[model samples]
Target chain A: MAEAARPTFRPAHTGFTDTIATVVVWLIAIIVTGVFVWLLSDIIWHGIGQVSWRFLTEAPRNAGRAGGIGPIIVSTLLILAVCIAVAMPLGVGTAVLLAEFTSSDNLFGRLVRRSLDVLAGVPSIVFGLFGNAFFCVYLGMGFSILSGGLTLACMTLPILIRSTEEGFRAVPDEYRLGAAALGMSRTSSLIHLLLPAAAPGLLVGMVLGMGRSIAETAALIFTSGYVDRMPQSLHDSGRSLSIHIFDLSMNVAGGDANAYASALVLIVILLIVNSVASWTSDRWLHKRIIS
Target chain B: MSRSRSDIFLIWALRCCAAIAGAIVLLIGAFLVIESMPALQHVGITRFFTDASWHPSADASQGTFNLAPMLWGTLLAMSGSVLLATPLGIGSAVFCHYYAPSSIAKFYRRLIELLAGIPSVVYGFWGLVVLVPLIRQLQPPGPSLLAGIIILTIMILPTVALMADAALTNVPAQYLRGAAALGLSRWGTIRGVVFPAAKSGIITGVILQTGRAIGETMAILMVCGNVVQTPSRIFDPIRTLTANIALEMAYAGGDHRSALFVSGLILLALIVVLVSAAEVHSKGRIYG
Candidate 1:
């Protein structure tokens, strides 16, 4: 009778504790969601009014206090182009080596992965120092778009390679076996079959890398320079979108309006890119399932 | 058989790409060391640890290159953000995993990803425009260590929550079922079985976020008052190592520039240690 009473009494205590824990957890969830909503709305509320057609098409005047971010947009695109151009081939090739050519325990593959992991964690400001030292000073590139793009390439490669590797790894082993049975040369099979199948992964990696490179500021500050003029050539210095925002807000007094507008444009670009990535992956998944 | 030539070429090309990718890390390390050598030699390494303030001058002799205060600032901001984020992140993760409907959990995850995708500059801008002003009402000077902590906490919260969610999801379903079989309540089971099973993964995530928090630059630089001091109070302004490099590197030249690189080198060394520690902690774990 005593033991039964003890078990019955425990429910009252445990039940109360459970209810409190559940309430606390629900409260935390609501708070986290509320914070996100607040941040998004705050930016959108102030910035949406500032963004206009003219804002996207014209160059800034009075050190970004007036006019638009026309040249900054071009510079941002060119820098991104250079970054992707350099990173894609190297990233895809490395991913191929990791996923297809090498075994899981291969020493060289492990070394490469370890290095990439360390590289991914390296601070962007440090990358700025390295890029300034190597590309600008030692290589005599100065503070050009080329230098900044190359710096971004180094920063973006690890993310690209890792994701692409995962993409390749997700392909079924039977597909490879079938290619072998069909007497398809390894190069041909990888080029024709593997690449297409892993396209979603590659797309994801590219979008993520682009997003990171586009949003970069510290790495570009010392390497790409602070020039806000229309870039005449890849060799010339040009301020990127993020760098422009940093400068406008921090240095140029009364530059907040344009800063908010530019930030809105950047956020829009990121949202579009993210949506496209997910949409494409979703379509790919549907196609794969249907077939 | 003739196609074998192309295959061989493709193999070699990939090998070369992998080699280059691996070598870039070595190259970055080498360049940082070479660039920072002048400052390290001129100022002497011991002084960096012992000096009282950072006053980098064109003349190397006159400047005091002590990084201790900034180092302290970086660790303080990093630890504070991590401490605040850990509970909030894990609580959200737990909420999503056990309590929320699947649809709500999915939406929440997407929201977290969107939060993560926002650039650091924007966070800093937001912090400067909104958060700092709010804090200023409570305290006189707004752009202090507290502001940086709050901004950093928001910036890293998504990372922690997402990683923690993944870790929680990776917990074996059998563990929960076993607790249920033993008549344990849901929260009781989480406290006793689920958390213990997922401890290493959550720790690894936290450590990785620590690396990110320490290395973060633009956000902290924008809001933090950029004062070079060891902050005694949370409201006191502070400068981090990353911010130190970004702020001073533009006008810095000769040994001053080299000293900035020394700071960069220190940051890189710190990151390498954190990454290694995470790897060691997650070793042999499935979630790694």
Candidate 2:
């Protein structure tokens, strides 16, 4: 009866079909991997010789064809500083509210999450327009680093808030229960306990936000203006590294070497940030497991 | 007493932050709408949809503000990229999840993340220098709709592959075991069981990437040849709505600037619709 219950015979050609499918899957994987390797190697092979100490320290002499990216580097850092300073407080506060203060199904929390989802999905070009209209024109900031930084702050908030919320949520409930049972004040407990425990998540979110802001081109092009000179004040127009790369590659003839070097620098910065993020998270996880 | 007061203050601050974060989206929408009003009133809304070309002139009377061609171009590039990326992305995810050894899978995961981190402009530069020249060998115009599609496919592949990996990982192990107990082959189990379980997630990933492809500007602008027309062939030079705004906004003044804002408004609306669809399709995952 048991033998009869099973299929009397196996389906024919199943082996052939399975083998074919496996081969197709393997081919697809190889192709995808091959593309990635090709892109990275191509950039590195052409760009490596151009990256040098002088290239990193001097301003361009002949329309970005001759000099290093010193001023551009300064501008990028200043804009990034302004972006991080603004985004950090707002992002963390919102994340705390959603993860700690409100229930999952709370209406306000849901609304905020939905809005973030929409904002995250918004095209960066739309953000560029909004920044141009609201920050540069309406606010009378003109085309300056201040406006660019603010635009980036707005763009980075969605990702930062979402990730930080996830980070806060990951803290085990037992810790919260223990803190409350010990008569620790809500504020003190949160400051001393929850924040430290969630540091890895916070770091990851900040790194991701920084990466996105640093890579941004469309949003900064109009708000920051196209000035490659070192900006003395936040109000001064400045150019970011990504914008410089864009101008160099598209508008400037014979600017390919500098463009390649700039791209290589950008990729290296992103790589370091990414590794730091993963390394911190891994260390944190190991520490927790050990304790 | 002071500590409790500070706690109260902290709570209020957080609430304010949350409220502000939510309100920013509305503010952006409102601003875009207000900025676009001049074009809407001057050119009339129907002209945007009905006109045949996108020739924005400083003189409103002389300009034709037809956005249809660019709109079609945007959709075409988006759909074309999504079509090419979907199979490749899902296939790679399947390979990573089931076929590769654990060590190889981990390495592949890192590789995809690194791919995602590369900036759009860098990709554009690469596409312009390498991909365009390669394509031009076969076709006269190197920067065409095909180039845009290829760049976008690479850009959005990571998004789809990562999301699909998550979805596949989430599939209940019991289902796989049950399939094995029934003597189903590995391929049969994946096709009949894993795919069905992860269908919603995979669909959501594709939709999300579609939004990404639609919004992408710099790469498309760099490689798409920036011609304002509905492309009749894959090799035809085309302009996306995003490229249109970025290209003209710099010198555009008067009604022309307003017309560019109108394009931004449309992109915003399309994004909202896609995001809402994704949320609904994901079936309450937002709250979860």
Q: Best candidate per DockQ, number?
A: 2
TM-score of chain B of 1: 0.96
Interface RMSD of each: 8.3, 7.5
Model 2 gets an lDDT of 0.88
Residue lDDT tens for model 2, A1-291: 000011121333368778888899889888889988999998999989999999998988799998889899999999999999999999999999999989979999999989988989889999999999999999999999999999999999998897788789889998899988887877888899999888788888899999999999999988998999989999999999999999999999999999999999999998998788778777766777787
lDDT by residue for model 1 (A107-210), tens: 99988988998899898898999999999999999999999999999999999998798789878888999998899999999999999989899998999899
Q: How high is the lDDT of residue A111 in model 1?
A: 89
Q: After aligning candidate 2 to the native by TM-score, how far in Å is the CA of B216 from where it should be?
A: 0.4
TM-score of chain A of each: 0.92, 0.93
- TM-score, B chain, candidate 2? 0.96
Estimate every model's Cα lDDT from 0 to 1: 0.88, 0.88
After superposition, which runs of candidate 1 have C-alpha atoms over 4 Å from their true positions?
A: A1-14, A282-291, B1-3, B284-288
* lDDT, residue A136, candidate 1: 97
| Recovery fraction of native interface contacts for candidate 1 | 0.65
- TM-score versus the correct structure, for each prediction: 0.95, 0.96
